[model samples]
Target: MKRESRQTTGGQAWVVNRKKEDKKMEPKWLTERRQKAAEDFKTLPLPKTDEFWRRTNLSRIPFDQFEPIQSVTNGAAKGSASRYLPVPMMVSGELLYGEKMSPATLDPNSQKAGVILDGLQNALEKYPELVLKYFGKGFQNRHEKFLAQNEAFWQTGVFCYIPKNTQVELPILLASHFSGGNQSAAPRLLIVLDKGAKTTIVHYASSETENDSIFLNNVVEIYIEEEAHLTYIDSQALSDQTFEIAQKRIELETNAKLKWVLDIQGSKLSKTNIETVLKGSGAAAEVLGLLCGNKKQHLELYAWTQHAAPHTTADILIKGTANDAAKTIFQGMIRIEKAAQGTESYMANNNLVLSEKAHADSIPRLEIEADDVRASHGATIGQVDAEQLFYLETRGLNREEAEHLIVEGFYEDIFGRIPVESVREVMRKNIEKKVGVIA
Candidate 1:
């Protein structure tokens, strides 16, 4: 099938169409959704000045020059990733070389209770019914531009579906890299945990080359059924020239639990949103975000947790380190509906400014309509205390070394809560690199 990605004026970024390439043999269901998504991309004006895009400027990016990744249905890409992956993962395979997706089947030793773990193409080929049943179901009401663009032009995706009552003890990992050349990678990931199921996923996205320019538009959807549990960690270390616009939405049923962590360590300009909806009684969620911005980097993160059921609970904590001329924005909100009684929520945002030019903004909000509920929010923006710096320096450390230690202590509370050792190590190393330390 011949396909092409076109860049049009206005809000549309890239449109992938096979109409003139191949239409006669296209499946009816596949063609219709793709056609509708393409139409959405065309009609939906890219939010140039929308409130969502106000904090991070999208006008500077050359969207028309961004190229959509080409899909390769071969084995060479897998071989490349095998040499680069850090054991137990097939990251950066076809997605960067020529293939659009990295597909996998359940590991006999790791997977139990008939769980399904595969890529987008694999699920579409083997489990078409299930894939169609859940795809785009979580965000049917969100009319965001980047979300629609990602749905329309995604070249590859990851799908993890846990069976009812099954528990996966091992942490699943998916690593991906983007090569230089001003290309765009749209990866759509879906995670579904059935009733009483439990699992953890560690996602990684990085740059293949330091000097390369790239744009990443990604979407992730998580569905938690009654009494299920899901822990997800997203780590990004892209090139300094990369532009990223991403969104993650999660839906929780009765007695479900969601633990989410987002670590944004690199990118020239990054804008992301974390949305969680508690639709059933007794559902609970915890959201945490950590970011380190340096050298003119701009990062904006928004989080929203809505409580529509009684006895639901949520907690949010966001921490950041900004140095040089970098800027960071953190916005969090918790909404309790009128019918949701006995709801509990707490939101907090803290930042450490390491330079005089560095800037940070924090906005925490709460909307409560029900009775017998507890909700509170707090935000703080401060720098290293002069007395503490002097105390550390007098103890024999230089300014850089003392500052580094102070920054580490600033994020210790949040870092200690991360369960994965490897993830915490990655975040620590990146922070140390950004903040200077003695060799």
Candidate 2:
């Protein structure tokens, strides 16, 4: 086992101690991969000068002060797994992760349909060949420092597979709960849908402690096969004193369809990347995001959609609101390759600054190589409409109530597009609470 340490300029350092027990539990191939990633993680430097990172100050984060959790014990006995139970709607399956990842439970119908849902470690033991085939296929950038760290240290995660020609009517839930202070966790997720399959998945992450300073690095990979359809919802609500970084990669094949929704609300500082590749003809994708920042929270997101085949299409809409001294940033890009002659894509980001000290930034970019493609990008940043607020105030509402109503109305469009009603309702309530509309 090799131990690596990352030193900060301030003379502080954090060490990652590789456990022999973890290496012994996996096959030789996986062990080799982890070893390679660990080496890469040590050599790869943070992209501080990169365009995506120029706006944020990386040195200010005290990464060296947090201890990386190398192992996890069962959390069920500690009463931490029940936070996500009694979900608002029925689910085909549910996977819970706290200090540890639990065994997945699936409805009989789903299991009978040849669906596979299990903890990532368990899946490696039970379905080694299947997991190995699609393990790292979706990632476009293998050398990224954060990605390398996740690949090297991830110990808790979920693996979900839907067989060909099967349709799971109810959504599946994967929930992760984090607690404690000055601790770091790296969790990974993999979801694969075979040809002509259809399913819906909700990925939710939250923290139980409100003031704990924590660090979370997460990665998710999803593959949609030919003619398959998938709806994925990713929501994050961590503690206000935490630093979170997450990356999600998705690949769609011929005639496949995808609907991706993101709801971000918590974390003292959060940076997320969502990249989708339309690899085959007729593939389509729609991405919708909602960001709500309050207090001193900083939320940032980068969404990229690549049209690599003919007749592929994509649409992205992200709405954000910042209050107090919080800040929000959104960067969106749509790329059409030369082979994607009939591609049609559009990207838009809109933001509202509710307080004088609050700030919001939106960057929309387009790169087109196909002459026949149609692509457009736009962004807008503005404050609440005084006229609308006055109208609401005249209708017997105070200024706070009026602003809350306006914010709600501003996000209604994106909320209406959410495929899961339960998730949409939960996000709505979370936003309401953030806006001080409810206790």
The local lDDT score (0 to 100) that residue 376 gets in candidate 1 is: 94
Candidate 2 structure quality by residue, lDDT tens digits, 1-439 = 1112344221122223555545456788887777777777777777678998767666656677676765553445322333563347567788787456666778899899999987787889899999999998876356887888788777678889999999999988888877776778788899999999999998878875554577788899999999999999888877788788888999999999999999899888898989999999999999999999999988999998999999999999999999999999999888899999999999989999998999999988999999998888899999988888799889888888888888898899998898777888778878877885732
The lDDT leader among the candidates is: 2
Kindly give the number of clashing pairs for every candidate.
Answer: 3, 0
Which lDDT tens digits does candidate 1 get at residues 70-171?
543334343343333333342211222223334453457445467776666667777888888888997775666777777666666777788888887766
lDDT of each: 0.76, 0.83
As for candidate 1, its clashing pairs are: 11-46, 72-98, 72-99
Q: Could you estimate the TM-score for every candidate?
A: 0.90, 0.94
Native-vs-model 1 lDDT?
0.76
Prediction RMSDs, each to the true structure: 4.2, 3.2
Task: Show model 1 residue runs off by greater than 4 Å.
Answer: 1-13, 16-27, 72-106, 437-439
- Span of ten consecutive residues with least summed lDDT in model 1: 90-99
* Alpha-carbon deviation at 16 in model 1, angstroms: 5.7
Candidate 2 Cα errors over 4 Å, as ranges: 1-15, 19-23, 77-82, 85-87
